[model samples]
Target: MTALPQERRIVTAIPGPKSQELQARRTAAVAQGVGSVLPVFTARAGGGIIEDVDGNRLIDFGSGIAVTSVGASAEAVVRRAAAQLADFTHTCFMVTPYEGYVEVAEALAELTPGDHAKKSALFNSGAEAVENAVKVARAHTKRQAVVVFDHGYHGRTNLTMALTSKNMPYKHGFGPFAPEVYRVPVAYGYRWPTGPQNAGPEAAAQAIDQITKQVGPDNVAAIIIEPLLGEGGFIEPAKGFLPAIRDFAAANGIVFVADEIQSGFCRTGQWFACEDEGIVPDLITTAKGIAGGLPLAAVTGRAEIMDAAHAGGLGGTYGGNPVACAGALGAIETMRDLDLNARAKAIEVTMKARLTAMAEKFEVIGDVRGRGAMIAIELVKDRTTKEPAPEATAALAKACHQEGLLVLTCGTYGNVLRFLPPLVIGEDLLNEGLDIIEQAFARI
Candidate 1:
């Protein structure tokens, strides 16, 4: 196939006639609860642009929620996945193991943090990996209680729904969630009542105290967290907070798991977000960008902990699908060859500079926080009051959509604008996306 022009071009309305028609068919067929940010359907996507059915190219700042870090159609990813597709699709790893699955496990062992011997099990999604991580943690420690943080998003499954903090969309009506999971306060610097400077130590102390008194340290099996909170407005925990938490888990023998599904695979300027503070987790769950858009997830951790499960205790029918494994390998190769880690850092610098300036100019931008390419701007009705501006966020997102720029809004309060452009996106397209954001915010 030939290359796309690699520029944003609006030949029709945001949702042109073709897309509008498709949207009608979608409404008739798809469920009402399943939400989509934009009405336009994608025809093709690569690099930083998504070509819609109407033949309009929109600058992609979402990267499919950070799944396409190497771009939607990177050469290596497509080549390997296609080759695997042609060769054979599946022979369930549980029944008949394949080299691709083992290779992915080996790569994850080497790529994740720490020098200790590690092991991994593949799955179909981030939530599955997280649930498995919890399983292994419980099996290893022989404990039942699990700990999670405020505003955290693990997944939509029953057990993961309990692990997740937000409720409106993920867990509003889903009732009778798993029982052993516990919730605690996170070091959300912007919203911490005591102020950001003291958030780290105070929040850590609060969480530990709660766990000790309520759940009891002896019963706690694991503590899972997003080093950089994703759907929770991309809040980076206050300095020392993560290290303190990790140390606490270690001292108590509770397995520490880092949910890097959205923050890993070089999206955070590091191989994993846990590395920002030199923190090492007992286990790490990863997905999204791991396979360059393919569906794959993994639970990697210390060999002993990972091996604690019985022979038949873990795995799924489609876990580590050959094609997805191949895609993951290709994605890893792209990250190494393209040096996407450095690219992510550069993206952080450019975006922070631009967003910080925007915040200075606009009082609605209450906080601009996040590391590397996974950045966000939280909108507020007033900086002093810090009231969430969900309406303004909706308006801004609509404005960008009309202008042919694809952006995503997230946050527990639904007041944040997140940007996650593919690592291979050109500087010009990245800047153009930012320009659209600035202009859209100005209109708002």
Candidate 2:
């Protein structure tokens, strides 16, 4: 496939005529439950830009929701996947395994945090990896209850929905969810009632106290958390908060799991966000940017814990598909060759400088936080009151869209604007996207 121009160009309106037609067809054929952030139909996407069917090129700040860190069509990933497809599609790893599957597992075992003897089980999505992690924890500990934090988003599956905190879009009316799942307080510095300075230790103490009093530490199977909360407004847990929780889990014999699906893969300047805190989890679940754009996820952890499951107790028919495995190998190679971790750090510096400056001018930007490329701005009515400004957030996003920039809004209250540009995106494109954002804020 030939490369589309890297520059953003608007030949027509935001959705354009062709995209509007496609939107009409999509409405008729697609399920109402599914959602798309933008109505434009993509003809090609790579580097920093997505070209819609109407020939409008828009700077991509979403990166398919952090799944395309190496760019949506990285050359290495495309070549490897194409070669694998030409060779053979699938033979079912469970029935007749392939070397690609084993290789990908080996890569994960080496890359994931902790130097202990680790093993991995590959799956098709982040939710599957999380579900299997829970199963492994339960099997190993022979315990019942699992603990999660406020504003954490695991996935949309039955068990994960129970684990997730948000109710409207993710869990509303979908419940009567899985049992034995408990909720705890996260050390969200911005929203902590006590104040940012005391958020870490106080929240940690409260969570540990609640867990011991309500769930009983001995009965808890696992404690799962995102080192940096993703769907929960990109809230970075206050310093020392994660280590405190890690220590508690260790003392209680509860398995500690890090749901790094969105925060992993060099997006946080480290291989995994948990590394920043030096908190090594027993099991780390990953997916999003694992295989360029193909569907693949893994549960990597201590050998004893991963091996706890009986011979046939784990795996799915399509888990670790060969094509996806090939894509993963290529993606890992690209990350290493390009040193995407450093790139992410550099991007963080650029973003922090710009967003920080913007915060100085715009009081509506109540807070600016996040590490590396996974950054966000929380919108509020007033700096002092800090009342969430969800409508303003939506308007800003729409403004960015109309000006040929694809931005995404997230957060429990839908009052955050997140930027997840591909690590491979050029500096020029990054600055251009930020300029559009500043312009959007001015217009809104």
Candidate 3:
């Protein structure tokens, strides 16, 4: 919408003079702990392209880490959000309620899985939504333990960091996380000790056994998971695995929570990834992609469970800011009007075909997995042993960046190259980004 050319063009180097200057200023001004994947300072971004301050137009394959599915500045989102900004910025929702927050909650109820009477409480971030979800589950079930899985990534908050399995960057120095969080094995098909065919049942059995024997199922308040693992390699759980876990949670009266922060809102070809298996979660946490780049998150679930918390138990000062709610409403409107679910499915078909072909050609590509636009390739040194090629993954990402294509790498081992192009990206731009990736592969 910003009239910026929807094509990749490298004017100077990757971090041109202006960007380098900003990077120097950033080093002086910004905190050392705040990490930036790319140092280029953006002037404007829209429709799969980010124009940096130096006039370099880079093809955006990351979509701001999947937050801009309708593009960074969709017409509807910009218009509605602008209108709301003119009207009011924030009323602190708790102090003075607004219609926009209620509208967003209504939208979430309709869009998120489950037909049962549902209610939603909005928050400012995915981590906060997850934290509240755990709180609500504990309030409803009256239990203390929460179960997560290996390689899972929740967020940077203390409770979420404990729920998260990765240790280095997310949890290294942050110590003394919240107690009563338990980790179990996930049905990681590619890296499972047993074969993929048996991975689902075996992993489910082991997790259930762990909960029953070690954590004690009766003490478990909830079992939270990403239907399609997000920062954990974009790994889709093996077939039957989610259903088995869901059934176990139901039997044990443990709330089943789906953290759809990364995999929700049409990124996974479905409104939510859990819908792929028709597994309706008792509580679902959502954020990223909900508000077209605005910070907003939510916990939507069964009415009874959601209502379990006391009146003063669940809200924050900035929760459900009216401007962000307006953006979410606009995003949902755009998603429906444009049919982004179909677009995501098409992206998957296109990307999988090309990536599958690349896997056939390149021995370094150990696995090509994920649904819809949220896909990834796990690089490895050897096919048989699956020794992670983290160095190669980093090299390939850097090469793509130099070629004016923005890509992101993620996974527990840091060897996964994830592709999360905007659902609105044109076929030509999408293929061009893939071409850049293939060329990077060739060079590596």
Q: Evaluate model 2: give its lDDT.
A: 0.95
lDDT of 1: 0.94
Candidate 2, 23-124: lDDT as tens digits: 999999999999999999999999988999999999999999999999989989999999999999999999999999999989998999899999999999
TM-score of each: 0.99, 0.99, 0.99
Residues 1-444, candidate 3, lDDT per residue (tens digit)?
Answer: 447788889999999999999999999999999999999999999888999999999999899989999998898899999999999898898898999999999999999998999999999999999999999999999999999999898999999999999998999988999999999998999998878998999999999999999999999999999999989899999999999999999998999999999999999999999999999999999999999999999999999999999998999999999999999999999899989999999999999999999999999999999999999999999999999999999999999999999999999999999999988898999999999999999999
Question: Model 3 compared with the native: what TM-score?
Answer: 0.99
lDDT at 110 for candidate 2? Answer: 91
Where model 2 places Cα greater than 4 Å from the true spot, the runs are none
Candidate 3: list runs displaced more than 4 Å.
Answer: none
Candidate 2, residue 146: Cα displacement in angstroms equals 0.4
Query: lDDT at 172 for candidate 2?
Result: 91
User: In candidate 1, how many Å is residue 233 off?
Assistant: 1.0
Q: Name the TM-score of candidate 2.
A: 0.99
- Candidate 1 vs candidate 3: the lDDT winner is 3
